[model samples]
Target: MNIKSIILGVLFLFMSGQIALAQSTGTEREITELSKKKWEWMADKNADSLAELFHDKAKFVHMGGTWGKDREVDIIRSGGIHYKKAEIHEVMVEVMGETAILWNRITLLAVVGGNEVSNPFMVTEVYVKQNDTWKLGDLTFSKLLTRD
Candidate 1:
């Protein structure tokens, strides 16, 4: 093969790989978006939507720094947390095969304990692709303190 042909072939291969990567990234992005929607529903106090995403053995940790699915369920069920208005400002996703970790920062205007709660927080969630569907495997939230 001529030198130019070799270079052209290499460039084609590189572009093909990039296209594949971009496609993968796009798919991963969809999964991440779904996960975010679930979180939004969680804060919205739409219990069922949040429940569906959680794996049976999923680990859900709260801003209070507590762990356990049952406890998380109890908290979710008790109705203290509600996302009256929510906005996702940023989301960063890292994917490896069937697993993904998403780091997100969201602002929530909610009603908690009958008091209006405006929370700006950061969350990290792990999602696992199972049977060609993404499910929430783990979640943690940290509240951001605002200096008035």
Candidate 2:
């Protein structure tokens, strides 16, 4: 292929990716916003809100252990691990039919066992739509070595 053709092909591919990203519709935006609010709710230790959002069989995976929705809500309510703040650096959401998956890069500051700690994590959240509402099905935090 000629140099000009190669360049044009590369540009086309790049623009196609951009268009796909730009085509994220209202549902995607809504899910993204909901994820952001979830982080805020965590920081505030608003277990009531979280309880409502979490599905009945929701699972939460942490660095320490994994548990179901009730335990997760109780932990938050009782301040077992207080999510002080989540400095969200990046977030991406993809919707597939009635399911949405969201990934977030964050620096999380938290109080665990009465000690303040900070960590970088790539958090994955999965939500399933039931009726007209979306409920969080799973939330898993994967610790990242670099702060970035």
Candidate 3:
């Protein structure tokens, strides 16, 4: 009711909002780390870890085709599409409520159909928080014009 009390209340609200923003940023960092782990798992062909990270309804899109979680897992498990290495140029992540979007620019070395290929791609990954844990909801890879 008083002027001093009003100003104090506003300051309190502002500080609380800042705290929430900091927490969200922390979550974004966690998702980023999880994403890096996913790339490692893919390179290692760790289907079990991938299965746990990917949501049951997750979808994957590639230059060749698009598929659901099961097919993607199978592809990685069977060496149909082996991710040999990823040279990450940059990664940016945004958190929106329970969903997070990650954008990554990288040079990917992969073995597909018995042929080894290296290409630059911009990958977008969508993650949704499920039971307080982030799970991959969708992933798409777009080929980049520049090889570097």
Q: Judged by lDDT, which candidate is best?
A: 3
The full ranking of all candidates by TM-score, starting with the best, is 3, 2, 1
lDDT of all predictions, in order shown?
0.77, 0.94, 0.96
Clashing pairs for predicted structure model 3, backbone only: none
User: What is the lDDT for 40 in model 3?
Assistant: 98
* Per-residue C-alpha lDDT of model 3 across residues 25-82, encoded as one tens digit per residue: 8988998899999999999999999999999999999999899999999999999999
Tens-place lDDT per residue, model 2, 44-73, is 999999999999999999999999999999
TM-score of 3: 0.96
After superposing candidate 3, which stretches have Cα over 4 Å from the reference? none
- The TM-scores of all predictions, comma-separated, are 0.78, 0.83, 0.96
lDDT of 2: 0.94
As for candidate 1, its clashing pairs are: 43-83
Give Cα distance to truth, residue 125, candidate 2, Å. 0.2
The C-alpha stretches of model 1 lying farther than 4 A from their native spots are 1-12, 146-148
Error of 3 at 83 (Å): 0.5
